[model samples]
Target: MGELMGRAVQRVSHEHREMAAERLRAAAGDGLISIDELDRRLGTAFLAVTFADLDAVTVDLPPAPLEVVAAAASRRVLRLAVSNGSVSRFGEWEVPGEIELQLEHATSTLDFRVSEVPATGVHINVQAFRSRVRLLVLPGTYVDLGSLGRHRSTVADRHGRAGSSRELHAVRLTGDIRGGSLRVLRRPYQLF
Candidate 1:
């Protein structure tokens, strides 16, 4: 009875080790593991008399690499302005030449001015909105809106906003002359 019990334990241990070896092979791609190492580990596992020995033989296996990679990538610089169709959403705006602006699905007309080739500051007026407006700003730039009012605006920064500058980078205004909301984001490398 004692000898039969010992043989049964040995058979289970050997099966467990074989399963562990198969798993290791699946994780590490072709040719990564040497035939000698595989044979050695398998021999150790088959001969392992204790659970501790079987556990030790299966340790230290590497993880598999991801099969799919995402295609869309992030950009370094971006400027966006949007508005819906309402009198008090966006009005008049100004932007420095150093920065570039992209308009998306905006119903209201935009009045923009850039003093130099690369704008240093920006201004925007939100005259109307049937829907909310969204804007994305890049790093190392400054944004300013002298005043913002009404219509509940939200600004999100993935990294953070820029520091102070001698000049401005961007500015925006929304809604009618009296009521609405205004938002500004600035990224300044140097503070003078």
Candidate 2:
């Protein structure tokens, strides 16, 4: 649990830092900060390596508009339960803060490529009994199976079992899998 919490303070990508810096610039334009403050925050934002560091750059700025805030908060959790059947969640869906999946002798497919990921990341708890769950995620997102323990169920990832860079959004999976299987695959990059 301690390790998980430590990992939660994730390193953010350069793009994310740049976005935060842009937001700071926007805020300054709105008179939230002076020109000098904007320059200072912009410098800090570019130098920020972690999400927390970038967040600090404009933490004192005014909140976003109500509509945007509501829309973001609305994408909370996606819960699904199945018994002896196949369930699929994909395409233009919002990846919630937590995905709770309960399966009993069933199969599930979850695709995150076409989904919107939350800023803080996502957590997936799959409780299975004699079922199989297939999770298709984006390139940077990782699947951590450390807490899965020694159940009859097995977790396999075609890309690799090791966690990706901390800069990527993390999907922490924790649950009991008795006589079931969990497969995590990274989607192929598409150029369109």
TM-score of each: 0.27, 0.58
Off by over 4 Å in 1: 1-120, 153-168, 172-192
Across residues 71-177, which tens digit of lDDT does each residue of candidate 2 receive? 34334567899998978886666566678898999999888777656554567787889998888887656677666643876778767556542333566777788
* Model 2, TM vs. native: 0.58
In the range 1-192, model 1's lDDT, one tens digit per residue, is: 987556545534333444455544553446656777777776776777665566566556653222210000011123444543322222223222222232333332222321121222334444333333333344544444334444344433345444553344343333332222223222322323
Q: What C-alpha root-mean-square deviation, in Å, does candidate 2 show against the real structure?
A: 12.1
Q: Largest TM-score belongs to which candidate?
A: 2
lDDT, candidates in the order shown: 0.39, 0.71
TM-score of 1: 0.27
lDDT of 1 at 33: 61
Local lDDT at 109 for model 1: 26
Q: Could you say which candidate leads in lDDT?
A: 2
Error of 1 at 184 (Å): 8.5
